[model samples]
Target: MRPIVVLLTVLSTLIFPGRAEAATTFGPREAGVNAWPYHDGGQLPKKYTGVVDNQGVRMFVHPGITGGRKMNHPVAQAQYGLALVNNYRRTHDSWYLDLAQRQARRLADTHVDARGAWYFPYRFDFPLSSGIGLTMRAPWYSAMAQGQATSLFIRLAKATGSAEWRRAADRAFRSLQLGYAAGVPWATHRDAAGRLWLEEYPGPNPATSARVLNGHIFAIYGVWDYWNVTRSPAAAAIFSEATRTVYTYLLRGFRNPSWASSYSLRGDVPSEKYHNIHVNQLLHLHALSGQPVFAAMAEILHGDFTMARVTATIRFSGGTHVGVAFRSTTDGRVRARRGLTLGRASSAPVDQRRRIGGQPGFWYHVTKGALAGFWVQEFPGRRSTTGPIATFPYLTRRTAVLAKGSHLVYRASGPSVARVSATSEAGIVRLGWVDGRRAVLVSAGSLRGLWLVVTPRTTFRIAEGDDHDEVICGVSCERVAPLG
Candidate 1:
């Protein structure tokens, strides 16, 4: 009977392989746009108009700071720039490209030092403090920011034929590479052995400790990008060494087969539970690197350290810090219980938990009464109460439509979120309400032979495709309906 069930599952996947094609969209919906109640510039209530100057060059919504100045940290600046570059690639809008260029210039002028090694202010609040000063030259900074900047500049140079951008990217990569000492990159010069170090001293020491995993992972990611852009054998070798070293340490120091534990190199027992978004990014890196052990570790972390079960409490007044815990569950559903506090840090914890149900994915507070986003699909099977899921949230006024056919296009007026199922078998897609409007389309594929249902409330329309054999429907929800 078990073998029969397995065979049926395999046959279903083969007949309807939804995994072949990439999703129409990827990444978190609320990314770049500030969902928090903070005053970040780009996250303002206004419509996103391609990172305007008035909106500021930095993507973070914080006021008073403009251009890359708004982003004191090299990592933050790189992430913001990367987001802009990605947006430009998707939309082909020159504004995003221009914004990335401006930020890159600012980074080159302000962050890159006389030593040709790029370093950034560790924190926006700390001016010329020692902690900040030391981190400015940290190898972790180079590892995270340089590759992103290089990738962005390379793309920009090609797009606009700007030699300056190309040169700047080359300089940045060379500077970052120069920061490495011996096989192990120093987390801080304040220490010998070139071990990992943390900038936020007296709080949590990340250097020379196993906690270097976070920085190590970022370093690997940057090296990967460097290899992609330059195709340099040196970059490839660096990537390989970094991956091997981190994996060796992670497995030896953190792995606990019994608990399926893969901690943040903190070595403490409960510290393993705190592994949030970093674990996911590492999993992605492992998958990209083609390392079986890293990939296997990723799976274990995902299965055991479920983020859905965890809840966060954040106080962003002075600076951001959060505590996380796995939500206690009774029957398979998360109980509406208070979240456990995991402590705080400088920034919001990364949201790494896979989605479940037809709900969107997020790590912060969800406005319960307010309609935000909904979940659409789960991969590998029709649906598992527990598994990897995708969600689409329409935060703006624009409406979206997911056509019915196997080959369907989901659309949004501006930047919208669409969740594609991980697998094609019994895949489901969802859209959030936009002033009470909805639309749906259908396609004719083998997967269509199975009965598929889409429920839309408020206003809707049906568009016939080719013949009667193909039909699509559109719906709108104004009065508010429960999304499950």
Candidate 2:
């Protein structure tokens, strides 16, 4: 019976590809977990500690599925490679390293086309299709998937000093940098403005030729990462040019201080969702480049109150220094209610006993929910907020603020309170505990700077870093009093 199911899965992957459901013959009971989320057979390997960074909390791979469901989504396959690398970094585990190499080879060999185009079916036929990039929203080979896969290959090459991976990375990089001959009229094209934009799909009018903000951002970030590691001149040129293109598009189209979920290459925002995806993406871009424009764009997109909508206010049992960060939309509407009782972060903030219940909604999890650890420590609800809010540097320590035309993105840690002082622009917000060195980047409106802080919630400390020298006033901070 098991062999039959496995055979079916392999056949489905080759034939239908993205339209097939995962095989459910493999059970979570074998993996020692009670009930699995998403794909049934998938499990967090027992050895995984779920600690942040240098290790993934969960593996979306399912034993019953061909390529363990990673092949179902292009980004997932690449991220799996990342997880493999991260696990190796933490445990010095040879198993993970070997698995990563094998995974990379399979993906490149099976999916990649002659023109370096990856046959990425962005939509999956799974139950949670609506929430994720299902419904066949975009084209087969999206910038997000290609860019991420390229980065994964490059990273693998750097890690193992393998020429095959490097060659693979180069091919994908070319397809991304220069539009591939997708072999169909509408497969790839350029907009009237003469800017190159990949076909999101081979169907329909608008969907056929378009660009997604997050997709472009992800690809650009991946290119940047590749350049950072290898310092390849070709990779660097592509990264620089792509960054400029995205920056220009964002400034012109997303200037309303809010954004539609995605926009076409012709600069038409198809539809708008009340979400923080744009904010998070911009924040990530800012983190990568430290460019004021990206920070400014983040400040604008931060007004989308999706983060507030996902937040469930839970009380802490012990005396832990906690803070709540809020973001509002352009219409002066705040999504967060002042005091709603929901779940709580563990007073023993260090304890990882309380796992979030069930899988978060696909869109929520990708845009904001995945980064919930950086905001809250833990909670019982599938969507809960209950920890130090480290969304932004300027207001990292604020308990609450009237989020009007402003968005807040933060990551917090530690149970005890500590006095942290940066430039004047960098407010005196009560941050959660810090195990070691954590650098904080603060930006409220035009004020932006990197500050000397302690370590990330869970990370190894590095050498000493420099501190900023300027000071400025606070914008919307709540807690001005110090903790006793």
Candidate 3:
């Protein structure tokens, strides 16, 4: 039997539609087809409204949420099931599938079969300033919930051949039909443009709409799911109409000029997270309809031109001694495993890292340690490292050190990185390490600003580099000279 819930009151003192702000509706963070991953899942015990049931689910009625006592959010629950189902899809794990089935059963059982529409409703009242409304009453439903539930049910039915899931899907589609007015509450919203939008919030007045972008897209996914699996003519109509609305008004209605996509038709900007969602949804829409416009916008919105990149290494002059700096395999400057240091037990060099932005001067990858990855110059404070980086000590009498640095390029900031800054002479410089006493400077000029070490020494021999891994030339290699 379905739950005996009714449509909440409208145009009351406590409830009305919203205009400016946009808050997150309880649903999937990312937009895509079925089997898409869920960003979050089932709530922790602390969120429970203290009402427990045999189904092990409770209403999450936190204070400051609304004026009503408590209520279970069908939208949230349906998304949770989606997460579990996708988890099962990725891992072939039966546990997640079983849990998803149970969730679908709950949704089917509690559906409000009233006014000739099988609507799944929100039991609690919406808080003041909610993007959907300022003071929404209890038992309100949304096209998003109905669509997601419809998607959820039909998916399970098709995959598992369950009769109950299909029946629930059929009934849920019925609610998605009528506009959110009169006895039929919350589903469709026909905009002023005459484009029929599956509204996220068709608040107290059915004529008004939140016209939320992500919500509309998510609901379309459900309708798309229905049409794709069952090929019902009605489902096809809904899918066609909803996507048509998106394709037609996507830029004019939802885009905010050169900024992030609008949260609603109200010219409100979305956060970075939601912007990513927008990009994904647009790309997915392009795939679904082969629309060039969505793909072009997605590419533009997902700008990667400002990424950082490192090309090569720089060299410094050490008078008598050079401090060993380790570029650990764990440093953000370490882009990838550039092959291991042969025969060495605990030290290797890496070339890439992330989040090294706003850091000036040259950045050297640190050695392996417990701390999170951070950028460094040729020298840094004492830390742990199994491999050597480029930092050093034994500064000039005045203590002014110079080094090379790099800039950002396209790609993930933290995925991996390259070398930082430069040298003028041979485009390279190597300051050899002495026995904690002497330093070797390659064609080193003015070692102490006015001091010069002669190349015509009685005896000069090529030796191991400061990293103790390879041998370099002892005399002037002709390609390097100190900046002096």
Which runs of model 2 end up more than 4 angstroms from their true locations? 1-71, 116-139, 180-189, 196-207, 255-274, 309-484
201-225 per-residue lDDT for model 3 (tens digits): 6667655557777888888778767
Indicate which candidate wins on lDDT. 3
lDDT of 1 by residue, 43-129 (tens): 222233434345345533345333344344555556666666666655787777766676676667665353554554344432222
RMSD of each: 15.8, 17.9, 21.3
Question: How would the candidate models be sorted by lDDT, starting from the highest?
Answer: 3, 2, 1
Error of 3 at 105 (Å): 2.2
Off by over 4 Å in 1: 1-55, 59-71, 121-142, 179-211, 255-276, 309-484
Per-candidate TM vs. native? 0.47, 0.50, 0.53
What does candidate 2's lDDT look like per residue over 394-480, in tens digits?
211211211123223333442223332321223232222122112334334232322223321111101012111111111111122
Total colliding residue pairs, candidate 2:
23
Q: Which candidate ranks first by TM-score, i.e. highest?
A: 3
- Superposed by TM-score, candidate 3 places the C-alpha of residue 173 at a distance from the truth, in angstroms, of 1.3
For model 2, the run of ten residues with the poorest summed lDDT: 468-477
* CA lDDT of each prediction against the hidden true structure: 0.38, 0.41, 0.47
